[model samples]
Each structure stands twice: as structure tokens, then as C-alpha cells.
Target: MTDQRAPLIQRGIVDLMIAADRLRFQIEAALRPMGINLTQMSLLNHFSWQPDRAQSITELTDVMAINQPGVTKAIAALADRGLVEKIDDAEDARVKRVKITPAGLEALGQARQAAWPPVEAAFGSLDDEELAAFTSHLVKMKASLAIS
Candidate 1:
């Protein structure tokens, strides 16, 4: 006999993907007016958290889960826009570390304001207990995947 649990497992995975996609779309739409996508916003958010800590491209690759070229390109674009800056590492002049500029912090604040409504609306229907459970599940899954 076929495994009865297979369909249940597949449906759960599919439902998670669908929900993630819908949330992403809503966030993207909300951020479009600011001329940034989730990935860029994520980069800004990372930098904003520790404005003084300059992180290398390799570090950013791990955090953003994107390839080096993409990170480099995004950094270049943000640098061009005066949102981020790349400076030579103190110990390693060959390596460049990126940090958020004051403008980036300002943009990040604006982006958060723009993005918060959609995120709040998406979870507004969930009661506190339900939301906490959902978050715990997501955290467990992320840990299982070794995502930082």
C-alpha cells in the first residue's frame, strides 16, 4: 500500500510556500514606491541593526543567502544611491567592508513605515496564541534548515 502520510506532508509544504509567496508579493508591492525589493530592504535592515559594524561581502552572502555577485551588485547600486558605503578593512586593505550610511538609516526608517502596514494586515486576523504558534513553527523550520 502507498504511504498515506506522503500527501499530507506534500500539502503542508505546498501550503507554506503559497503563504510565503503571497506575503512576499504584498511586501513587494508596498515597497515598490520606495524603489526597493525585499532583498535590498533586508540588506538595509541588516546594516541598520549594527550601524558601526562593517561586514565583508562574504559575511553578507551568508546573511542574505544570495551569491557573491548579487551582493556585490546590490552593494554597488546602494553605494551609488548613497545608502551604503564600502571601505577598506582596517586589517585587510584588500577586503572591503560595507556599512550603512546615514541616508540608508533614513531610507530604512521610511521603508519600514511603508512595509509595516501590509505585514500587520497579513497577521491581523491571527490571535496572539495563534501568531505565537505560527512564529515558533517558522523558527523551528529555519533552525532545521540551518538558516541564521
Candidate 2:
């Protein structure tokens, strides 16, 4: 004889997957009109956030938790679209650094402005304390999961 009643256990990865899917859907919807996908937007955002830092495809792979080939493909596409430019690394000519162009910056700014209002509205019902607590918990979870 065995006990048949047991509660289903949900892991952090399951929650993360759901959240990531939702975020991707929202971002894709926001970026569709601009002819950009989530991957391109993410790269652009990274460049905007760290203007001084020179990021390579490999670096982007690690930061984005994606593969090198995918990042390379995205970079090539963005370059073709004139949204990003590849510059030779000063110290290592063999290495290429990615930088966002003026057009890319403008696009990113517009996308951020347009997307933030809706996202803010969704979360705005929460009080400041609740928001802070949620943020803190999320940060801890991310740290625990070793998600950069």
C-alpha cells in the first residue's frame, strides 16, 4: 500500500521560464513595429547601458546566456540594418567590439519609453514597499540561480 496524495512541487526554473516567456512576448509586441526582435533589442539595451564597455560576441553570449553563433548572427543582422557597428579591438585586432549606432540608440530609447509606460501601469497598483520587497526577492532568486 502507498500514499496517493502528494502536493506537486514547483521549482524556481519553472517560475523563471514562465516569467521569461511573458517578458519575451511583451517585448516582442513592443518591438515588432520597429522591425526588431527581442534578441536585437536586448543587445541594443546592453550597449546603451554600458556605452564605455566594448562587448564581443563571446562576451554577449555569456551575458545573455545564449550561444556564440546566435549572438554573431544577431550582430551581423544588426550591422546589416545599420543599427550597430563593429570596430576592431585596439589591443587585439582579431577581436571585434560591438557598439550601437545613433539610429540604434534612438530606436532603443523610443522602445524603452513606449514599453515602460505599459509595464509600469501593470505594476503600479503595488505600493512602494511591496514593489521594493518584490524587487529584493527577485534579486535574491536571481543570485541563487546564478543568473547574470
Candidate 3:
């Protein structure tokens, strides 16, 4: 007899990957009109949420799950667009801290407003119970994958 477990495992992995890709694509599309990609939007959101805290490139790399060069490039792009400003850390001149500019805040607000409709529509089909359960499952999954 064939092993039933193999197909189940393969299907689960493929489905998960496909679902993630589709969700990412949808989010990217929603952000494209704002002239910002999903990665930059995420960084902007981080800044918006913590306006007072200046984030270092290493901190952002860990938060964004990207490499040093990627974080540096994204920050450089945002700085070039006048959305963010970089300042040298007082304690450690070798480190640079990034802060969002007023223009960045405005753009982030606009992007969030524009992106909400699609997200609302996606969740509109779920009832309150289903939404809660889905959110709980996502939280658990994220925690499970958290780096120790």
C-alpha cells in the first residue's frame, strides 16, 4: 500500500506556499500605486507605530527578516525619497538610526487608507468566530516559528 502521509505533507506545504505567495502579491499590488513596495511599506509602518524610537539598520534587519544589505538599501531608497532621515547615533557614531520624516508619515497614512479596503473585503466573508479563530491560529503559528 502507498504511504498516505507523503501526499498529505506535500500538499500541505504546497498549499501553504501558494497561499503565502498570493497574499503577498495582493498586498504588493495594493501598495504599488503609492510608489512603494511591501517591504518599504512595512518599514514605514514600523516607524509610524514607534515614532520616537530610532531604529538601527541591524534592528530593522532582524525585524524585517532581511539581510544587512537589504535593510541598508531599503533605508537608502526611503531616504532618497525624503520619507526617512538617518542620523548618527550619539553613543556609537558607527551606528545610524533611522527616523521617519513628516512626508513619510503622510505617505504611510495614505497607503494604509488605500490598503484597508482590500483587507476588509478579504475578511468580510468570515464571521466573528471564524475571524477570531483564524487570528488565534496565525498567532500560534507565528509564535511557534519564532526564533529562540
Candidate 4:
């Protein structure tokens, strides 16, 4: 029974991965013309969602699921572009926080506008019922995977 289930499990994982990769590829293509990558947009999105419009490096790592070095590098790049600021946390001098600037929000808005139409169209192609099922499944999977 275990041997029989192995191929089924592997195929299921492969199919899921392929679907996800394909969707990501489409999204990347949509965003490429706007000169923004998903990671950068994600950072801006994170700041938009944040109550204070800032996040400590430690909090970024935990919330973004990225390592310190990666977070630091991205934050530095954003800062260099005048999209974000790296500041010492008021509550903790040792903790560095990333804050999105108005420019960042504007850039993020542009990027989102460029990306969302095609991305939404891809989903729009799906039937409403199918989309709902897929969305619910994704939500369940994210929770299962501890994504947030």
C-alpha cells in the first residue's frame, strides 16, 4: 500500500509545483515591463499592510520568511532607490526597522497596476465556482504550511 501510494504522492506534489510555477512565471512576465520583481513588490506590500508602515528587521524575517541577510540586502536596495528607510527602532536601539516612503507607495501602486490586470485575467478565465474552490484551497494550504 505504501509503495502504491508513493507515486501518487509524488505526482500530486509535482502537479501542484508545476501549477504554482506556471502561475508565478506568468506573474513575473506581467511585472517585468514595470521594472519590478515580486520580492520588491512584496516588501512594499508588507509595509502597506503594516500598522506603522514599518517593520523591524527581526519582524521582517519572521513575517516575510526571509533570512536576515536577504532582508538586509533588499532593504538596502530599496533605501538606495529612496523607496524605503532604515531606522533604528525607537523601542529598541539594536533593532533596525524598514519604513516605506511615499515614493515607495507610488512605485508599488504602479507595479501593482501593471501586474494585476494580466494576473487577474488569468484567474478571471476560471469559472467563479472554480476560483472560489481554488482560493479556499490556497488559504487552507497557507495555514497548513504556516505561511502567516
Candidate 5:
């Protein structure tokens, strides 16, 4: 039974991975004209979802699942582009928090607009019911992995 299930399990995982990679490529292509890459747009999206549009380097590292140096580098790049600013934490002077500027939000909104068409295209074949079921299954898988 285990041997029989192995192929099914492997195929399922591979299909998901390939789908994700293709979607990522499409999104990246969509974002290219806006002078933003996937990782930068992802960071901007994360900040937009935050209450204060701000987070510490450590927090960003944890959420992005990247190393400290990488987070710092991305933050610096955003800062240089005037999309985000690093501020001294109110309570902890030693900790610097990165906050999105108004321009950052504007860019994020534009990025979303640019990104939506490809995403919609990807799902356009699915009817409403099918889309909902697909999304529900994805949510369940995310939950199973304890991902938010």
C-alpha cells in the first residue's frame, strides 16, 4: 500500500510545485515593468498588511524566512528607493523598525494592479465554484503546514 501511494504523493507534490513556479514566473514578468522583483513586492505587500506598516528587521527576517543580512539588504534597497524608511523604535532605541512610506503604498497598489491580470488569467479557466474549491483546498494545505 505504501509503495502504491508513493507515486501519487510524489506526483501531487510535483504538480503543486510546478504550478507555484509558473505562477511566480508570471507574476514576476508582470512586476518587471514596475521596477520591482518578487521579493521586493512581497515585502511591500507584507508591510501593507501590517497595522502600522512597520516591522523590525528581526520580525521581517522571521516572516520572510530569510537571514538577517538578506532582510537588511532588502530594507536598505527599499530605503534607497525612498519606498521605506528605517526608524528608531520608540521603546527600544537599539532596535530599528522599517516603515513603508506613502510612496511605498502607492507602489504596492500599482504592483497589485499590475499583478492582478496574470493572476486572474491563471484562474480564468475555473468557474466560481471550481475556484472556490481550489482556494479552499489550498487554505487547508496551508493550515496543515501551520502557515498563516
Candidate 6:
């Protein structure tokens, strides 16, 4: 018997990849004029989730899809911009963690506002309910990929 599932799986994977690239391009275009790279914005979101706790590079590596070098470079850029600060780990002096500065929070807020106009215009075709459902599936896909 033919493996009918093969075409479905292959097409789904290919479509997802294409969709991801398209969405990333759109987001980058939106974020660019704000003077923030998409990498920096991603780091800011990760850091802001636990503002009090410093997030270690190792922890970020464990959970993030981005490679360590990319994370380091992005963090360095943020540091250079005064948007993030490095904190020494209490247990290990050599290890460092990152926290978003107050300025970083302000930048993040500004960036959020900056990203909206393009996103609103681009996604105008999708109603709120469709957008919500699309987001739900994306979350599920992300979680599934994380385990893989």
C-alpha cells in the first residue's frame, strides 16, 4: 500500500518552513525601523519574562532554538546599547546571567508599539478569531519542535 501519510507530512513541513520564513521577513521589516534587530527583541522578551532573575546563557541555550554564538552576539549588542546588564552568578563567579535594564524595558515598550502598524496592516485579512487560532497552532508546533 502507498504511504499516503508521506505526502501530507512532507507538505506540512515544507509549508511550515515557508510560512515561518515569510512571517520572519515581515516581522523583521516591521522591527527594522525601530532601530532594533529581531534578535535583540527576542532576547528582550526572554529576559523580561523574569525581570528579577538573571537568565544564564546556558539556560538560554537549553531552551532556545538559536545557537549559542547567535545568543551571545545578540546579548552583546544589547549590552552595548545599555538595554541589558550582565550579572554574576552567585554560585559561580565565572558564569554570567542577563537582565533587562530599565532602559531596556522602555525600549521594549517602544519596540512593541513600533511593530504594531506593519503587523496590523499586513494581518488585516485575518480576523481576531482566526489570528487567535493561528497563534494557538503555532504555540503547539513550537512546543512540539522543542522536544524534537
TM, every model = 0.90, 0.79, 0.86, 0.83, 0.87, 0.84
Local accuracy by lDDT, each model: 0.91, 0.81, 0.87, 0.82, 0.88, 0.83
Question: Per-residue lDDT tens digits of candidate 2, residues 40-130?
Answer: 8888898988666768887889888878988999899889988889989989889999888888888888888766765776578899999
Q: After superposition, how far is residue 106 of candidate 3 from its true place, in Å?
A: 1.5
For candidate 5, what's the RMSD? 2.2
Which sections of candidate 5 miss by over 4 Å? 1-4, 51-53
Per-residue lDDT of candidate 1, residues 40-136 (tens digit)? 8889999998998899999999988889999998888889889999999999888999999999999999999999998999899999999999999
Q: What lDDT score is found at residue 128 in candidate 5?
A: 97
What is the lDDT, from 0 to 100, of the residue 67 in candidate 5? 81
lDDT (Cα) of model 3: 0.87
Residue 7, model 1: Cα distance from true site in angstroms: 2.5
lDDT of 6 by residue, 24-128 (tens): 787788788777888889888877787777888878777667889988998888999999999999999989998899999889988878777766775789999
lDDT by residue for model 4 (50-94), tens: 525677887888988988898888788788888888887888888
Candidate 6 lDDT trough over 10 residues, lowest sum: 114-123
lDDT of 1 at 34: 86
lDDT-wise, the better of 2 and 5 is 5
| Residue-level lDDT tens digits of model 5 in 40-135 | 888888888863757899999888877899888878888899989998899999999998888999999999999999899889999999999999
Q: How accurate locally is residue 36 in candidate 6, as Cα lDDT from 0 to 100?
A: 83
Minimum summed lDDT over a 10-residue window in model 2 is located at: 1-10
